[model samples]
Target: MALVKEGDTITIDAHARSLHLHISDEKLAHRRANCQPLPPRYIRGVLVKYTKLVSSSSLSALTDFNLF
Candidate 1:
């Protein structure tokens, strides 16, 4: 997947079944290199626990009970 910066323009062609991001490769690479992981939103409690244990939705969001 390509990184799209804020305010970047995107073009979607339904007939062509394609999407394009109007960003230079160099700029995208720079953004990727400087990107930082966001801090977890939940500090504590059930939501925190859920985040730690839940699997991706494609995997049915199954909680790994063994992790608890």
Candidate 2:
């Protein structure tokens, strides 16, 4: 877990297997104590299809940040 002040943004890997969140720490304790549980919502995932050459060329183009 990471602690950040307002206006800060943190990134986490969604596919990471060994990730853990420690709420007992002082920073997160308040959130754990006050928040109520909510039902999970369903979100549709997007699927992309790319051939070998197409993916390689796309990745090469992506090296230039302005493309996106």
Supply candidate 1's per-residue lDDT for 18. Answer: 98
Candidate 1 lDDT, tens digit per residue, 1-67?
4367678899999999998888888887898998887888999999999988889899879886465
Q: How badly does each model clash, as a count of residue pairs?
A: 0, 0
lDDT of 2 at 15: 83
Worst 10 residues of 2 by lDDT: 45-54
Error of 1 at 60 (Å): 1.3
Count of backbone collisions in candidate 1: 0
lDDT of 2 at 37: 62
Q: What's the lDDT for residue 17 in model 2?
A: 50
For each candidate in turn, the TM-score is: 0.71, 0.26
